[model samples]
Target chain A: MSLDQQPIVSRNPSPAAPPAPGADAVLVARDLSVWYGSTQALRGVSIAIPRNRITALIGPSGCGKSTLLRCFNRMNDLIPGFRMEGQLGFDGDPVAGPEVDPVTLRRRVGMVFQKPNPFPKTVYHNVAWGARINGYTGDLDELVERSLRRAALWDEVKDKLNRSGLDLSGGQQQRLCIARTLAVEPEVILMDEPCSALDPISTARVEDLMEDLKAEYTIVIVTHNMQQARRVSDMTACLMLDEARGNGHRPGVLAEFSPTDVLFTTPKDPRTEAYITGRIG
Target chain B: MSRASDALYRPRRGLRRALGAGFAGLCLAATLSGVVVLVVLLGAVLVKALALPPNPPWFAVGEQLRELAAFLSRIASSTNSPNPELAGFKAGIIGSLWLLLLVALIAIPVGVGAGLYLEEYAPAGRLRRAIQTNIANLAGVPSIVYGILGLVVFSRAFGFQALALGKMLWAGALTLSLLVLPIVVIATQEALRAVPPSLRQAALALGATRWQVIRDHVLPSALPGILTGTILALSRAIGETAPLLMVGAANSILFPPSGPSDYYTALPVEIYNFATLPREEFRSVAAGGILILLGILLSMNAVAIFLRTPTGQRAASRAIAQLGRLGWSGRRAGRSRTGLASAVVVPGPGASGPDSEVAQPTDQGGAES
Candidate 1:
């Protein structure tokens, strides 16, 4: 039970390890580390997110899964005193570069937060706002309809398009958020525990929607639920807390990255095996 | 033994009830004391004003209203006169109304803008913190101090000497505006701060520029609160006398102010002049002026409360909703006109048809697993 008696497990893989040869990665993070003030959250974590697939980051609480997901779209930049070391690139261009405007970057890389956050506007406006701000001059009605249908929420909300987005049910609101993100036509969509706030039925619907959405846009999801990772993700990256390192509260680092089946059935790292088996988190 | 112990532990209900009743009585007395003083003061003023009666029913509400209307008309039409009975507040009313208009025109926009910048866009550092603290302190500063400041700044420093704006209506208006600006800014800032952070985050995440987010989301939600605060600030400015006095508001004028640069006297100033004179008739006139001032302030407050109500908000949203529908319909008509060209240009990316390509991978992944 003592702290020193715990095993010093090295979850970090060699830097020379290349991504799967034929995989088309839309995002490539190299030695990514994040710190909030002096407290580190992610430590040299690296992963190549494949295109047209759901890459789910699964781990326990305080495992930097959400932090790593936010790093893809640079959401962490919103936080004060947030420092990032290492490179995150989208389509071979550095995300944190001075030339890369976060506004434009975010447009191309949309995000869905953990909670369902819809602007206090109508459903139609919620979807249209993103496109409008991005200077989309096309038929907004058509676009909003298309996005809602793609999110599997068109039938429920088409009649009440003028109704406030906040008036919808929680599940509908989340789908509205998804539709809003889709309206902008982002190349990649990042979701941070998108279904954590929903009921089982809503979560299942979102999972089904995600499965359908993977063809045109890449998705990177952070989930605390192990079954969700197994059910929806094509590839699973398990991150774990490295308590023995740094000032007793060291940041989380990736323990295993493999196909979902491989990670579930035969994890390369013992820590990942322990986590997936529910022995220790 | 249990019963004995229970009796020992139980509270003295009678004594406790007595103490509660005593405290309640004290609070009731405290509230009534204020009401009592107000009623006594108003009664005395009314008795003095109505010293002479014309009919049998001297205190009828309708009769009093008629008399008040006649008295106000006399005051409105009469010019300044040496006779105490004929002296009126026509110049005061006009000056006050003009001052109110100018103060609102200048203060609301400036104060609200400062509030928005401070609350939304200002960098959270020492400079912003210092400015915030200074604004809060300024709101608490004495009105007379602001008067002196206005006298030096707007009246003397900036006012062209030949134009004589230093002792004009505009100068008094400027002083009152400055006196209330800090209050308006502080209230507006509080209102803006009450807006949910999630709304901002949602807008920003949708790729909105900061200004767009504020204009499109934040401002609409904070509108009611902002209006209420501005109204309250304006009301305070309307009733202010000390600042105007310091800025040299005239005690008497022959005619109403013709322009911003003309000499002016306000309701409070007129009342002060009349009340200070050694004449009973002038004191009654001053009481009448006080009644009118109270009516104006009360009406302004009522308007503020009404606007802050849910019904007012619903009306506003309804108007916005109508506009939205109009725009939507107009766009629909335009699309119909350009149907062929639009069809070719639309469906650029992430459209439903292209989704078929994305759907395949998900199907394959499910099959493979």
Candidate 2:
């Protein structure tokens, strides 16, 4: 079977390729299609996100990478007219099943958005808000401190925990958002262009934090910056809009998914190769 | 060539400058006309209040202050005098206070709840749009119309009389609350809408339930705007006589309202009654009542402004700090160094007071798109 045809074989590794040794699948998508009303944003995209590793979705604008990331946590459900049809499994459980509450799914799979969106609250409350609502009866102060420490923001914010979260610089605010997500103790963190709004220094800090974070939490990041994918991600999935489909409202499709080194060095699809080499986006 | 170019530009520039100045002068005159009319009317009212035909000495500033003190004492004593000159607005004040309390109790929760439902939970459809349009229309409906509705629904249909709530303070309050409900809801919806979608998304991504997000983040951020709206609505409610009249607020009442289900007359209604009398002495009484009404309205507005202004919050915190210092000094005189150390170590509720009150609104205001 060719690489393009293997996606149709459900519940099996691609016959044209095989899973890398010891890379466990934490999240697996099979022919996932998403639509916002009549507009199909993603079509028949399939990829498995490995546990304890970073998976980067790299694509040009209008490629539905962010939409796919949002689908993992059912964030897309918040948008009116958003519809999805496909198999999406997290740890072998159906994510879109009626029995699986989006709220509960979101608790297990936190997301960091493109822009830094800290609550108009104190730095302390920003981190503690998630835990408090989740009925965490433990020491919230300690949890806040630990989360901030994990996000590498403790030392800078320790003196002024009562200050508003928005008082922080854009970079610090993004880290504060990360701390907020981390405080929930999610198994997976889906970041949609987390570093897109940051300066290089802050981006480096976040990238480094992601590297440290991957030992415990599976991460899926959608990035426009290909160099970021190469530097931070363990595995990379390249998606592209299918221009021939849907009469100019074409849906995004997964073109390539491989280990970061393999995909960057030897991308099987010409589109992926073109995208990586700056020939086309 | 430069002189010729300068000559060409100068006349046009001068003309533009003159036009700007003329416009500015026109605006100034327009503003001053309102201010001048207000001042003249206020002066007339003051003169009438302080110097009625027979008893100019009684309404003298010093005598008026003494009378005010006596009136306050009379209110504290809960006595009702029938004499028009000495018939202090004790009953009206009490009745208005009762009405204010009831209106707040009824309007705020219902209005805010409606606002939340409309803004957050209501789907974008014809029903929601229709409801929004109706709310806007309701806000524009005259106060007297609300009173008529209140009379029909609350007094006649509900038979509040049969239920022992006849022509009472609560009935008037209900009417006034209904009159202002749309205004409050509209204001609250606008305030809630002003909250950034990003904040809501942030909370949701953290796995917060919708209510949890609203209560913890959105409400706190929107509170200043909501409060400003509520106070403005209440101020309008306080001055409304036509609605209260329809709802059966007594033109004249002998006794102060002791409870919700008692015969009542608000300050505006009392002022209106006093103003219409054939006697000039009654005019002084009416002027006095108007002054009192203006004072209440102005003070409510002042409170709203204080809450809305960032600098006002800083000033309030400074005052609080001064009070704290006074307490600290008193403690220092009574106790030793250990007490001071304990004071420094113990984080009071006030520690987070200023920022929580001040920061959210300022940040939200700045961040609002």
Number of the top DockQ candidate: 2
Interface RMSD of 2: 7.5
**Chain A: TM-score in each candidate?**
0.93, 0.94
Candidate 2 lDDT, B1-369, residue by residue in tens: 367567655467788999999999999999999999989988887777666434436437787666654544443333234455465577787888888889999999999999999998898999999999999999999888998888887767565556545587877988899989999999899989888899889898888898888876687667777888999999999999998888788877778889887888898888888778777777777777777788889999998898679765445444543453344334324222232222222245666544442223223333342
Q: What is the iRMS for every candidate structure?
A: 9.5, 7.5
What's model 2's lDDT at B171?
A: 76
For each candidate, what TM-score against the reference?
A: 0.86, 0.84
- How does residue B326 of candidate 1 score in lDDT? 51
Alpha carbon lDDT at B218, candidate 2: 82
| Residue B137, model 2: Cα distance from true site in angstroms | 1.2
Could you tell me which residue pairs clash in candidate 1? A215-B358
Q: Model 2 compared with the native: what TM-score?
A: 0.84
Candidate 1: which docking quality band?
acceptable
- Candidate 2 regions exceeding 4 Å error are A1-10, A14-20, A244-247, B1-11, B53-84, B158-161, B311-369
Q: Once model 1 is optimally superposed onto the true structure by TM-score, how far is the C-alpha of residue A8 displaced, in angstroms?
A: 29
Please write out the lDDT profile of model 1 over residues B1-369, one tens digit for every residue: 367668667688999999999999999999999999989987777665554345436558898767767776776677666686788888888888999999999999999999999988888899999999999999999999999898888778755676446788888988898888998898889888888887877777777788878877888778778888899999999899999998888978888998888888888888888889996778777777777787788899997898789887655555554554454444444442232223333234543331121122223333444
Error of 2 at A132 (Å): 2.3
Which 10-residue window in model 1 chain B sums to the lowest lDDT? Answer: B353-362
